[model samples]
Target chain A: AQSVTQPDIHITVSEGASLELRCNYSYGATPYLFWYVQSPGQGLQLLLKYFSGDTLVQGIKGFEAEFKRSQSSFNLRKPSVHWSDAAEYFCAVGPLMDSSYKLIFGSGTRLLVRP
Target chain B: DAGVTQSPTHLIKTRGQQVTLRCSPKSGHDTVSWYQQALGQGPQFIFQYYEEEERQRGNFPDRFSGHQFPNYSSELNVNALLLGDSALYLCASSLWGQTSLDTQYFGPGTRLTVL
Candidate 1:
């Protein structure tokens, strides 16, 4: 079975500080990894995804993730955090061969940016 | 192009009642997948529909069913809903038939509450 783990349940950082959300996945083979963000009472927004090729994938909203297959990790990072960037973050894994993939997600990490 | 959209943004139902949520995939997307997101948790895969047929399913019970129309829109039907079934149901759209990989665009999601 495939699964994702986001060890951080909650993280608070000052505005303009660096941010990193760790994610680790368990899959038998190479898996499709993704990061998604959700604001309060809003639908989820895709931050970044890694299918293949580049280990470093850049996404919208000034976010980027590095996929380290050997470590079985795909951690999301941002150079500087903004107050509006506070939200819930999720890491997901899916099948590599299938286009209509079923996503397995982690428990999620809540980010709180402070002034 | 318009992004994926879900109807009945919020729904309230009693235990043992039945509810149906609808989703319209993004333009040019042929596959629709459903997910259940509990409060304070990440989303879990429910199933995926492509070409009006279910291509993949998660560990959900048979009480959860769905249908995809010829126009590529979809619906999620939950019968004999329990209080535990209360969650935000998300609909994601992706292009099928690709052996390699693709991104699944998500909708705003429908919030269901069971009393």
Candidate 2:
């Protein structure tokens, strides 16, 4: 079975400070990893994804993630944090079972940006 | 292009009642997948529909079912709903048959509350 783990349940960062959210995945084969953000009462938005190549992947909102195969980690990072960046972050591993390519997600990490 | 969209932003139902949530996939997307997100947890895969057929399913019971239309829109139906079934239902869209590696685009979820 495939699974994702986001060890941090909550993280508070001061505005303009660098941010990092750790994610670890368990998959039998090469994994399709993704990061999604969900604002309060809002739909989820894709932050970035890693399919193959370029362990370092950049996403919207000036976010980036590095996929370290050896560590089984795909951690999300931002050079500076903003108030609007506060949201729930989820890490997922996908395309596991059937052709529909279902995704398995982690519990989530809540980010709080202080002004 | 409009991203995926879900109907009935919020609903309140009693235990043993039935409810149906609808979703329209993003333009040009042929596959729709459903997920359940509890109040403080990550989303859990429910099932996926492609070409009007269920291509994959998660560990959910038969009480949860769905259908896809010729137009590529989908519906999630829950029968004899329990209080535990209360959660935000999310719909995701992706292009089927193009490449198995495509990312899923999510819609604003429908929140269901069971009393």
Candidate 3:
């Protein structure tokens, strides 16, 4: 079965510190990967996506993710953590089964920024 | 454009009742997709509509149905709702694409609380 795995349910980082959130996926073919961020009581916003070509994709709000095909991983990264950046992050994979546009998402990781 | 828009930000329904949620696709988007986001989990795809037809669907039961109008707006109807049906319902819009690589923009989502 195709699915996404976010091992960390929650992570905390101090303001101004670097942060990384791990994501792994299981799929048969080359998967379309995406990262989304959701603030409390808000809708999800697309952070970035990896379809083909470049493995390192830069997103809004100074966020970026590197897709490593060998490990089936697409980890999101930020050079400096900000208080406003604390939110829930979701990793999703789009499998090309029957040309369906459905997205299989991970359980999600909640980020907490400390002062 | 105005981006995707969903109506009735919050709703309450009882078991065995029926409910309908509406969505308006972003300004130039031609496809609309529905998703169910349970507490503490990522969103799960329900279905997608394009050109007033059901294009693709996820693993949802028949109890969940949808309709798209000529104007490219859509509605999702759930029959015989269960307590487990209580979740955040999200609506996303995208341009018609042959693959899942198309970028989907999301709405604020409707919070459904079933009793």
Candidate 1 per-residue C-alpha lDDT over B1-115 given as tens digits, one digit per residue, 9 for 90 to 100: 9999999999999999999999999999999999999988899989999999998998999999999999999999999999999999999998986635557789999999999
Ten residues in sequence with the least summed lDDT for candidate 3 chain B: B95-104
Clashing pairs in 1: none
The positional error of residue B80 in candidate 2, measured at the CA in angstroms, is 0.5
DockQ of 2: 0.60
Tens digits of lDDT, candidate 2, A1-115: 6789999999999999999999999999999888999999898898998878899999999999999999999999999999999999999998654345588999999999999
Clash pairs for candidate 3: none
Off by over 4 Å in 1: B99-102
TM-score for chain B considered on its own, for each of the candidates: 0.96, 0.96, 0.95
Candidate 3 residues A1-115, lDDT tens each? Answer: 9999999999999999999999999999999899999998898899998888999999999999999999999999999999999999999998744444678999999999999
CAPRI verdict on model 2?
medium
What proportion of the true contacts does each candidate reproduce?
0.70, 0.53, 0.63
Docking class of 3: medium
Error of 2 at A37 (Å): 0.5
Query: Which of the two candidates, 1 or 3, achieves a greater lDDT against the reference?
Result: 3
Residue A82 lDDT (model 1): 94
Residue pairs clashing, model 2: none
